[model samples]
Target: MKYLLLLLPVFLFAKFASNESCKSCHPIIYEEFQKARHSHASLFKDPIHKAAWLISPDYKKKKYTCAKCHTPTDEKLLASFDYKQTIMPDINSTAQKDGVACAYCHRIKSIENNETQNINIISKKEHVYFGNLKDTIKNPFHKTANNKRFQNGNVCIGCHSHYRNKYGTNICSTNEHNELDSANCVSCHMPKVAGTPSNMKKRKQHAYHGFAGIHNDITMLSRYISVEILRGIDRFFIAINNLSPHALTLHPMRVMQLQVSVIRDKNVTNFKSKNFVRILGVDNNMTTPWKAKEIVKNTSIKGNEKRVSTYMYKLKKGDIVNIRIGYYLLSKKVAKSLGLQNNKKVNRFILLKQKVFIIKPNSFAPLQQ
Candidate 1:
C-alpha cells in the first residue's frame, strides 16, 4: 500500500519531517491541524500568546523574538532567537510542542518585507512541500510544490500582514491598504471542508486545516461577517458588513461587539453597546504592548468596510429586533489587566453574527424561525 505508506515516516521519525511526521500521512490534515490557532502558536501553548509575551518589551532580554512566527519548528527556538541566547528554548520542545508546525507551513519559500515583521522564507529544499493543490498527489512522504503563495492569500502575508512597534508606529495591521487586491487569506481562513487530504489521496474535498478564527472555528468565521437592520423613522441603523480581507480585529487584544435588542410586548429593551476597538497608548491612556507608542484610539472595522451602528430605538408594529455581532479575545478590561480573568477560553464571548428583525409595515422581516 504505497510501500507501506513509505515505510511510515521512515519508521517513525528518522525524519519524514515532523508534526509527528504528518500523523501517518496527514490524518485528515492532522485532525484539522489539532484544532488550529496554528496549533496554539507557541510560547508554551498560547495563553493569549503567553500573556502578551510575559509583559513584553522583549521579555527581559531573553529575547524570544516571538520565535519567528511563534516557534516555527524550533531550531532550538530559532537558534535562541538567533544567537542572543541566554538559554531558554525547552518548554518540553518539539518546537514547544509543534506550535506552527506541520513542516513549518509547508516550507514557505518567500516573503521578507521587514521593518519588524513579515519574513518567512523557509524552504531550504529538504523534502519539499508547498501547496495550493492542482492535483497534488505525489508523495512517498514529501515533495509537493505548486505555491502561488498558496493560491493567492500570499500565504497569509508571512504572519498576518503587519506589526510595527519599535517606534515606526502602526502596532497592528492586517493589510491596511497595501491592498494588493486583498480578500483571500486562503479563501477566507482555509475553508473547503468534507475530507480526504491524504490518507494517500482519494480526495473529495480537503483544504480546511481548522484555522477558522476568533480562536477556533467560529462558526466557520460566520461567513465573513454581516448583520444589516436599517429601518429609520426615529433612528435604527446597525449595518456592519465587513466581508473580510482584514480588520475586524487582528489582535491589539481584539474586541468587536455590537449587541442591540428590543423585544416589546414581552419586554426586553437592551441597546447600549457598540464597541470595536484598536487602542494603544502612552499618553491618551490605555497602554500595554510594551508601553505602547501610538494608536491611541480607533473604532476599527475596515476591509470592505460597512460599519453603521446608529440605534436611537423605535420600531414597534411587532418589534423583536435583536442583532448580535460579537468578538473579544481579551477585552474584559483586557482580561482584567492580563491576569486573563479566569481564561475560559480567553474570556469567552465570540458569536460573530446574529439577527432577528421583524418590524414590518415600513419593512423589516426575517424573524421567521
Candidate 2:
C-alpha cells in the first residue's frame, strides 16, 4: 500500500520482534511498553471505544486527525490519509516504531527542494536528534542506524509552519530553508521542558506516546521572538502568552489549534468571506460570523514595544492584518469518540499579534522611526 506520511516522527529505529522478542533484552522497557498506550492506541475492537465514535460529529465514532498521532499502528492504515484509523500503533514504543515510524516523516521531503525525498532522506539523524541504536537485538520491523533527520528540527516542520494568504487558504509556507527566525517544529512544540528528562536514553524512554507539541505551557513561555529589521536592525519583539494555562490545554482526546494571519486591507473586508472575523473573548463560546472573514493564521508583535504580542499577524508600516485566537472544549462526546473522554483535558487556543513593518535589508531602523 502507498504509505501516507504523517508530520510526526515515530520511535527511534531498533530491531523488531513480537512482544516475546522484546522481552529478552529490554526487560524493563518491554514491561513499560507492554502496558504503554501502544497496545490499545488503535485497537478498534473495544466496545466502548467504538460506541464513542458513533456519537462523534466529525468522525461519527470513527477515526480523527488527532487520533492518527496518538494511535498509529500500521503505516498502511495511515498511508492513504484516511483520517479514520482507530488504532495507530505506538511507533515510539521502540526504535521499531521509530517514534512515529520510518514511514511518516520519510515520505515528506524538503518542501523547499521540490524533490521526492522519502524516509531514506528525512530519517537521517542530526545533532538536535542523534538517531542511533545504542544497541539492540535484530528485529525485522526494526533497525538501528544513524537516521540524520530522525530527531532534527526538520521532522516537525511539515505541520508546524502552516499559513494562509489574504484568503483562508491553507498554505504550507514553513520557514523551511529560511533560517532567519530559526523556527522549526521543536523550537515551538518541544522547546526544552525542564525536568522532562534530557539524556539520550531518557529521550528514548519518553518517546512512547509522550510526544510534545504546541500544547506545552511552560515550554512556550520560556521562548521569545526578538525581531530586528535591516533598515539597519530596528529591534522589535513580540510574545505569545499561551492562555491554555498548560502547554496545550489539559486533555487526552481534545482539540487545540492556533492560527495567525496578515491583514492588508480593512476596506477589503468581506464579512461574508471566511477570512474576515470579529474577535471573541474566552467567555463567548461561538465561532466567527459565517458572513465575516477572519484572519485566522499567525499573530503579530510590535517592534517598538519592550515586548508586544498580538493574536493576529502584525501589519507592516503600510501593511494591514488581524489576529484571532480559538479554543474548543473537547466535549465529552468528542473525547469519548477518541477514547479520551475520560481524559479531562480542556482544549485551549490562544493567539496574539502586533504590527510588522517591511524594512529594506541591512538597515537598522525604518527611516520614519
lDDT of each: 0.76, 0.34
Residue 138 lDDT (model 1): 73
What are the per-residue Cα lDDT tens digits for candidate 2 across 71-117? Answer: 33244444544644554334344322332332343333343322211
Task: Write one digit per residue (lDDT tens) for candidate 1, span 218-336.
Answer: 87877667777777678777778888767787688888888888898998989778889998888888888656888888898977788777878678678878888888888888788
Query: Candidate 1 — which residues are off by over 4 angstroms?
Result: 1-56, 59-62, 74-77, 81-83, 86-99, 104-139, 142-192, 203-207, 214-219, 223-252, 259-273, 276-285, 289-314, 318-351, 354-356, 360-369
Off by over 4 Å in 2: 1-73, 79-143, 147-152, 163-168, 171-344, 347-369
Taking all chains together, each candidate's TM-score versus the true structure is: 0.35, 0.36
